[model samples]
Target: MTTITTRTVEYPADNLTMIGYLALPAGAERRPAVLIGPEGTGLSDVERRRAEALAELGYVALAFDLHGGRYLEEPEEMLARCMPLLADPDRMRGIGHAALDVLRAEPRADPDRTAAIGYGTGGAVALELGRDGVDLHAIATVNALTTGRPGEAARIRCPVWAGVGSEDPIMPPAQRVAFTEEMQAAGVDWRLVVYGGALHAFHHPSVDHTVRPGVGYHPRHAQRAWRDVVALLAECLPVTD
Candidate 1:
């Protein structure tokens, strides 16, 4: 059976207990570490599976709780609970730093080889962490709503790979364009994968919301984006088996 450990961690900034699940790769000795932030729905089974999948790729994965293990089926409720964290960027900044600290503290994780990947609100949060000068080696985002606007992108220090569906309504193309221009001006090594035939949260099969036709999860595109993410992390972290 695949080996994994489930536990809870405290975010010292807020002292809120966040339930975390850590999965290890085989024959681990300070493996490359990845911090996976949950979507707006909080820490779901799919999120855990995603973390485990990351571990299978020869990296240590930590699945973080976005909403403290609570699941909200209604969009309105999720918005109500998530707005506070988003409104105060400082909170995300602190949480992201804490997550990185947790990864670095892991005996089986390589501090030098660290990357963070997130979906939805978490994606924006991860990007914000990079913007705040957190020294994260790499970043992967899936359909993030915010992108630090035009001026803030210059502050990002790490390589960022943003994966967004062409049909993502929440994050408009204009915003993506502005974000791209900002990255160029800042000289940040960043790339974007605009999936031609997918909707928001394409990698997350558990989510049922779709805006329109021809805008759903294209498995082929999702798999390719994931491969690109892994390859990018390997290039940045250079973890050796």
Candidate 2:
């Protein structure tokens, strides 16, 4: 008997009433709340399930829609809405913090054990949240690039993990290599895994864009990545075992 519900949150910063779904595990006390960010395509049904899965694993998971319910059909259109936030990372941090606030404020969610995960451009937003010096327990990202902004890598105060597709052109391997190096140099506790034969949208199963070369699906990678995320949250979130 999972106590899950969905709601629309009106963030005061941008006056954006972002629709968010929350899933609460049954009988859980002082549970961790994970703020999940939608992909570049926005909050698809698949993302919802992913959040629910996290919720099933003894967490209060809240998946937020970054696009205000107007999902675009093309990458360009998605970029239009995502770019402005990217240009001024402060605003991006606002969105993540706002969503996180909404999650912690939930009756079933314990603010003490909070974390975040994101996909695609949304991953960038999650990173911004981490860089904003918020007190987060853990942060996980998929298919996201390193922002490389000065003073950012030094701001993370929690365990971090990232999943990348080996052949993801958008998040090229070389760049990931550099990102790892930076994380190492910063002495940040981070884990990065590259799925050997996967592409950019490996975690997104509802896509048929795999027909295009160097872009597609990896059911195996997706499953593994999803499992890894759950494991990370369980391991990182505040819990007394």
TM-score: which candidate is best?
A: 2
**lDDT leader:** 2
Task: Give one digit per residue, the lDDT tens place, for model 2 in 104-162.
Answer: 89887888778889987678778888888778898899998666577588888898899
Give the per-residue lDDT digits (tens) of candidate 1, residues 1-241: 6565555555543456666777778774778888888777677777688778877777888877666556666777887978787777778877777777887888888887778888877787788887887767888888774656446666777898888888777667997887777778888898888988677767766354433433356677778877887888888866686
Cα-based lDDT at residue 77, candidate 2: 74
Report residue 207 deviation for candidate 1 (angstroms).
Answer: 5.8
Model-by-model lDDT, in order?
A: 0.75, 0.78
TM-score of 2: 0.90
What overall lDDT, based on C-alpha atoms, would model 1 receive against the true structure? 0.75
Off by over 4 Å in 1: 1-15, 149-152, 207-216
State the lDDT at 197 in candidate 1: 64
Pairs with steric clashes in candidate 2: 210-216
Q: Relative to the unseen true structure, what is the C-alpha lDDT of residue 120 in candidate 1, on a scale of 0 to 100?
A: 79
